[model samples]
Target: MFRLGWFVNYGFGAYGWNQQWSGNVAQDVARPQLFEQGAQILENAGFDYLMLEDASVLYDIYQGSFAYAARRGLIRQDPMPLVPLMARATKHVGIIATMSTSFYPPFIAARLANTLDHLTEGRFGLNLVTSSPHAAAQNFGHEKHFEHDLRYEMADEWIRAVKALWNTWEPDAVVYDEANGVFADPDKIHYANFQGRFFSTRGPLNSVPSPQYHPVLCQAGGSGVGRAFAAAHADTIIAADPGIDGMRGYRDDITRLAEENGRSGKDVKLLHLISPVLGDTDEEAWARKRAMNAAADADQTNQLAALSYISGIDMSTFDLDEPLPELSDRVNGHQSSFSVFAKLARSGKTLREILKSRRGQETVELVGSPQTVADRMEEVMEQVGGDGFLVVMPFTRRNLTDVGDGLAPVLRRRGLIRDGYPYRTFRENLTSF
Candidate 1:
């Protein structure tokens, strides 16, 4: 009963890092085009969806300069356009785009999501996020980012408003009854009249409910409030837990929260991120992993800079050989990343040492032959309970093809992952498992 999806970061120079040495010559084509092709591959592999993790602004926190972020081309484009492109390219795999509830107004989000859901025939999902970066606040004309828990509160209101708008038009509102001299049923439509401290929307969305009723809601954050938000609202929780025990604890905690909120905890699907380096043999996979790491080492400066960008901590000021300095009591960005790395840093390990450890570097790793990779995934899912995983494909097209051609078939034959999607809508496909 394990499921799989691709964790695709679609903005900026997403695959620019992979173009350095990968065998994919198509890197010359536009990234959006390449992304569409990749989506097709994932659909053929029976992946549930391809989610776009996004960052809106530049990462200048590392050294008080945008030069590093610009040079790396980290994440620079709007992620919305790619959604329809992906949906048009494939029929089954879901398309998820990231949008910030803190920044995007409820009406706009509702319209965009509803439109995309219809275009994809109910295969669209929204990964709702609260803008995390301090600079992002400046872009939105706010003095500073909202406090950690408060952002979630704002998101809660945003969800309520958006959901109310979606439900305003009942399912039968659009009844093209020509014989009755009416194009629709007036009683079927009603105003939302939703009012909240952070957001309020009146009346129904212009469009009727899409095939899935509402787009599948996804939440991905590494903080306590984030967990609560996901447990209460999201159809899927894109978890980034690296170890079995950690994964179990995260799932249990969220499930309990869901129950406390008077909802079934099992309603939230947990998907942990893993990147596997696959080969015909274990040694070869390890070799490939080392090569990939070496390439990353060449750009370690940008890598660490990007880390600073996400963690909201300027890592550049610290000496590589010195233990990490004490971080803030709480980070406004990815709280878990800061907490986890800080704990590792306290072992008296140098910044360099911590990044070098598998625990620090790889979020979730499985490097081996097909059988070995499959075995590890099965064991982890069994130990961690239910839900599934999000596979991080190497930026190279070859690695992408290798995953679909090399590993997915093995997973299908072994019955660890599904061979085909049984439902038409994304939520149905997810719940069908």
Candidate 2:
């Protein structure tokens, strides 16, 4: 059977309300409590993991909530801090935190991830990211984001350095030789003075490695550089484009990339982001989607929020209801977003038309009854060459409930999803190893 995971777009009740600039909804929502509830739902539904995207800065749409978090001194909470808490609250679910290769130091990054794995009893995962957004650079003291190739170059070396550090402490390194008055054997550890195109790091990490070797590596870049990175390192690939053909093509590409590098295609699993809108009937589900979209809108003041959110080019210059010109070369950040935008623009779609097509363009949103949703999911898996899916909830809670109550049972009956987790580590659950 295929594996499944939830992509938690934290905040909002179940399909949260929109916020103005500088707002933080986490405080008002009592986020930790909601997170516990969300974790329970996903674990009960037999999900492999839940990924919390870590963004150090809140953009304009989230300004109000962001300001609230800062005022209450709640900004100190890193997304990874919630992982262990969630792990203790649930038995089978894995926890994944996004860590950028572009920012954090190698030893620190390895220690943090290793510590979480030990705490979670080996259910921890690392979502390696080469930070994309240019604005993200400003916050980190850089003038602009590193060029795409250079960023991946740094990431390649960074991974090599960390892996060597992780292996420094062998499985039986800690003999706790009290008789010899030595807690560890010095020979068991070695330095990783790795030098590459972008960075040079010396190591043996601060902490001992966890039982799982290293946490599962998940990646979500889809450009030339991104694919190369994923092929070389990731155990699973998360992507935004959820179309059957798109996913199949991506899977084939990654597989080919992996093989060219002397690894099998099975080394990496493909997960498509599926946003399901469930109801007793298709029309009812459609109605709920329309309502959710209407509610999430910033009262039309920022009708182009989605556009601006995806493409940094600021669609405010274009008519809200009109099609946009090809702007891939002009946009910043992930190339997949640019590719999607370019495809749409090439199709001669108007802005209004493109916005309307948001039904599944952003993700594969299945609006229908449980049977309908299950059938569609199965079709995608069987036909699209997909190994699994990453579901993006419309609103955090509601998305969880929909999948748990509506889709889970259906998928379970079809033998598509497991009734319970069969593996312990996140990597084992995701791959055949």
Candidate 3:
């Protein structure tokens, strides 16, 4: 059976806010009840994990105005506080929270990860991101974001420092010997004294080791430099290539990079990101997909604005009907994302056409009834080899029900996914297959 995970915004962005199926989520965005409920639903469906995607900037890049992102609720709240709440709601399912290496200090991030691991009882994972927005840098007192590869370079050092902190206390460091009046074995703890070009940290992590020792490292680096960083350190990688061939090539490349880094391909589990449209019947599902695309086509500016916010380019300045000029070298935000758009442009696609077809750019498409969708997913895994899929979708009760109560049953019956978690820790369950 393949591993399964769900990727969702932390009710932060316009994740079905004010949409017909959203219910009271928009009104309850500040509360934890909705997220807690969503976690339990995924857990009951036997998902391996629930990952919360986050961004720290109120984007104004699209048209040099923050109004667009603000009006659409594109600005995000911090996702850190919600990790323990969701973990408390689900016993087996893992809860992963996003944190940017660009902003967080290595020691602070390591300490928080340790604390969350204890709170979640080894069920916590941290998704590392090299933030891709100039606006985010401004908030952190930097005039501009670090250059693309330079940010990954910093992240590489950042992870090393964090790991050093995590390993400060040996596994046998904690021993409660009441008779001898000893709380822990002080000799077992050692200083990190880590120093690097971007960051430096001294001494052991104050918090003791939690359940997993080091919480599972998750990364979503799609660029060449990013892939190298993830290959060396990440336990699980979130891949968003568009098709099976691209997905296979990405996995193979990562496998090669892992071997070069002195680790086996199995050390890094790659999960392809997908958003499958499903219904009771095949026709209904296809119709729903068409409607979804039509809605996107009607709101081209909003789509482009979201893309522009991440790519750090004001796409509103470009001619929508003409193919884009080469802009990959100029992008300071997300080079991998810009590379995708540039590739589309090189193929003669107009900005308007690319925006219209952007629905599946972030994930592969699977549209059909439950059985049909499951069949396609099984075939995809077989073609791409092992590992699994991470489902990305709008956070609405209706959408959750469609996947958890509707499609999940079909997948479960077919034995395409696990019926329950066999291991206590998330890393164990994720690598169980």
Best by lDDT: 3
Best by TM-score: 3
Whole-model lDDT values for every prediction: 0.80, 0.73, 0.85
Which of 1 and 3 is ahead in TM-score?
3
- Tens digits of lDDT, candidate 3, 30-123: 7777788888888888888888888887778888999887787775667888889888888999988899999999999999999999999999
Return the lDDT, model 1, position 79.
74
| List of clashing residue pairs for candidate 3 | none
Candidate 1 lDDT by residue in tens digits, 37-86: 87898899988888887777877888888887766656546778778888
Worst 10 residues of 3 by lDDT: 9-18
Write one digit per residue (lDDT tens) for candidate 2, span 154-188. 88888887787788788777778888898877888
Model 2, which residues run further than 4 Å from truth? 10-15, 18-31, 60-77, 293-303, 359-363
Model 2 Cα shift for residue 154 (angstroms): 1.7
What TM-score against the true fold does each predicted structure earn? Answer: 0.95, 0.88, 0.97
TM-score (C-alpha, index-matched) for candidate 2 = 0.88
Worst 10 residues of 1 by lDDT: 21-30
Estimate candidate 1's alpha-carbon lDDT, on a 0 to 1 scale: 0.80
Query: Which sections of candidate 3 miss by over 4 Å?
Result: 10-14
